[model samples]
Target: MMKNRRFSIFIVIILCMVSFSDLKAQAPANDKASVKTFVQHFYDWYNVLQADDDFTRKHHLSPFAFAIKERGNYFDKPLRQAISDYFHKPLKSGETGLDFDPIAAAQDTRSGFQTGNVKQVGNTFRINLHDLPKGKSEKEILAAETFLVVVAVKVGKDWKLANFIYPAKGNMSQTDLIKLLAHQKKFGY
Candidate 1:
């Protein structure tokens, strides 16, 4: 009777361990799915901004605050606030396009600019974009105008845009871009 009781307890412990491992394995998949959904929604929001001339910067960009970081005095303000200031600042008389178009260099994903599905690499997710048009010369297509890599980081329960890395011209990360903006005193208010 004693031996049978010990065996039953051991079996229960093993089963519980197996179940816990299974749960742990499933958690990452769930997180990935959630992050992917968040990114899709973010792009949708970005598209809407393109059409509206008076789009609210804070309203659109604040939710991803967790994704932005300040380095030294390069950016003393919060990421979203800094971006809002940058967008709302007055431009010089001759400056026509002072704003950065997030999707300007990227080929439309709906039109086959994206190479593959979003890939999770370590803590960051990478989305690749190519600047290829329909009837470009072989050299132009092979040369590839620009290769844009958008990176996202998971912050707590949400995912945030971390950087837009452009590899052609020595690879500029979001932090680097913000630093340039700060240097130029583009961040306002």
Candidate 2:
């Protein structure tokens, strides 16, 4: 009787361990889906603001205005602080601090955008944002311009924007939000 009881207990313990191991293995997949969803929601909100004539006309706000206003909801502390400081700082004579929208990576907003491949490395995620051309099929979005790459990191219970990776433009090399902010200050731009 005693032997049987001990064996039963051992089997239960083994089963519990296996269950937990499986959950651990699946955590990354679940997290990846979550990260992808979070980015999609952000772009959805951003694009709506961009297309809203009343919102833009009434407030005279840029598309990034929402992100800046509710930064704490979208950005982690480090990234939030960097962007806030850069925008709020007074410019020197002849200094034009970032002329383009860093998040959109363009001077003019497109009619729409689509989220593309989302790749995760460790806790960081690189989510592709592609410009969706008018009258184009969903298949064509893959070939469309990759305007921005959002870098997101898990912050506490939620994912937060860490940086933005913009593609190379004419005369301007590929750059990120952190690097651009630092460069502007370093070169007195």
- Would you list the C-alpha lDDT of every candidate in the order shown? 0.50, 0.78
Can you list the residue pairs that collide in candidate 2? none
lDDT digits (tens) for residues 29-71 of candidate 1: 6665565565545545444443444443644542222123222
Q: Tell how far residue 5 is off in model 2, in angstroms.
A: 42
TM-score of 2: 0.76
Q: Each candidate's TM vs. the true structure?
A: 0.44, 0.76
lDDT (Cα, 0-100) at 154 in candidate 2: 83
For model 1, which pairs clash? Answer: none
Runs off by more than 4 Å, candidate 2: 1-27, 53-57, 133-138, 169-171
Q: At residue 182, give the lDDT of candidate 2.
A: 85
